[model samples]
Target chain A: MKNLKIDETKYTPEMTFDPETLVIAIKGKSYPENTEEFYKPAFEWLEKNLSDLGKKGLTVNLELIYFNSSSSKALMNFFDMLEESVDNGDNITVNWMYEEDNESILEYGEEFLEDIETLPFNLVPLKSRE
Target chain B: MTDCIFELKNDLNKNGIFFCFSGPISQDLIVEIGDTLKNKMRLEDASKSSMRLVFSIIIEQAQNIIYYSEEKVRPWSAGVNAGSISVGIITVAKKDNSYIITSGNMIKTEHVDKLKEKIEKIKGMGKDELKQYYKSQRKKDPDEDSKGAGLGLIDIARKVSKPLEYNFSSIDETVSFFTVTTVVAEGL
Candidate 1:
């Protein structure tokens, strides 16, 4: 499968789905007017790649500063898909990154993990680069 | 100059309002005003999380206008990416020790009752209950491809320090003006 890369815009996040690397990274803000339209491709890619990547394991990195409620719902669906992959015996790890000292963002990550049973989800605090 | 205009400014000043906008709201405008608001909050020494909370509410309110407001316009006549626009009023003001964000727009008269019920339910929930509701609502499928989680107001209700305030004023037989105001305590 080919990789998909979408650059970040003011109202949407950057998305990188790599079949070769077995990694999917979504970063930045997300509040698109059409949440389904924005996230459709990622879901499609995951559906196609989950089987192949299941053998080698996959890593998903999420580094979101802010997302609208619509985006939040889309994210929950995406994680559910990932959980399904794990249920099918895929080795998946989700790394949720948030700014240091921001417990609210961290809390969101925790909330997302509450329902998943098998995926190894980690909340990684992002330190300032400066 | 117009005396009434001066009086309006005075009225805003009397209420401790520092920023206000009315008319068309687009994604670009939200980013511009949101950046300025974040900078102002930083200058005021608001905590990082508080700034983020205020900014998130701003985006949700702006998106509510863009997606659901009855007053909409097409900014571009033709393009693969042409977009529709929505008009609304948004204001940020200070009341006592809290920061208040208010958004006003027009909605179909038929939607007023449902909106009222939703807001009333959110207003009655405490923080933990709000969190539980938000989680369950987040898991539900979107009613349509165009619809969202339909939880913006509930999410806003979660961040607020007190009960949310809202009003509906009839403008015609078909539509009404809807306004929602949420407040975040200064130190939260």
Candidate 2:
């Protein structure tokens, strides 16, 4: 399947999915007016490609500076999909990256970490991006 | 009318409000407002976390207006297919070392009771409780009438330094004005 690439917008995050490497990177702020619409394509891509992923493993890196509540819900849905894939015996891991000083973002990551049942979710804090 | 402009400015200043906007609200406008507020807070040397809290509150409140506000206007040039923008007012102020964000918009009278009940329940929740509620709500599908995730108010409740404050006033038989305020303590 073709790779998925969405450029960042003022209110949306940059998202890139590499089918060959089975790595997906999402970075930047995400507060799109239509949260569902903004994430629909990625969700579709994952649905279409999940079977092909097999035992190859998938890595998702999420580095969000800020996201509004709706976007938060979208992220939860994204993780839910990943968890379902993991449940189906697909090898999947997620890395939630946040700035060390950003307590709120770190807290959010922690909450998601606590919620996941089986997926390997990591809260990786980077040094302050000064 | 021109003379009243000066009085209006003074009134806002006296109330500690540094930023205020009223009328049609769109997604693009929310981005501009968020950026301007972020820059202003950064200049004041506000901590990153405090800024994030304030910014998040503003986005939640502003987007609520965009989604649920009863008042709306569609630009004639945009044609019929273009969507209408909601009308509302949003303000940011400083008081007692806290940043205050207040937003008001018109809402259908039928929604007043349900909305009031929702806010009252959220206000009664402690931080931990709010966090749990937010997570639970995030897992559910948004209500049919909801334009965004139904978790916006709960998210605002969790980040706020204090309980959410809200009021409803009847505008007529069919609609009422609803206003909600959130506070973020500086130097968090």
Kindly list the interface RMSD, in angstroms, of each predicted candidate in the order they appear.
1.2, 0.7
Candidate lDDT values, in order: 0.86, 0.91
Q: Where does model 2 sit among the CAPRI classes?
A: high
Question: Candidate 2's residue-wise lDDT over B84-148, tens digit each?
Answer: 99999999999998999999999999999999999999988888888889999999999898999
Q: How close is candidate 2 to the true structure, as a TM-score?
A: 0.98
Instruction: Give per-residue lDDT, candidate 1, residue A93.
Output: 90
Q: Which candidate has the top score in TM-score?
A: 2
Best by DockQ: 2
Q: Which stretches of candidate 2 lie over 4 Å from their true place?
A: none
Q: Which DockQ value does candidate 1 get?
A: 0.82
- Which residue pairs show backbone clashes in model 2? none
Candidate 1 chain A — worst ten consecutive residues by lDDT sum? A46-55
Q: Candidate 1 — which residues are off by over 4 angstroms?
A: B76-82, B143-146
- What lDDT score goes with residue B161 in model 2? 81
- Tens digits of per-residue lDDT for model 1, A1-130: 7999999998899999887888989999888878988999888887887778876988989999888898889888888888888888889899999988777779889988896677789999999542
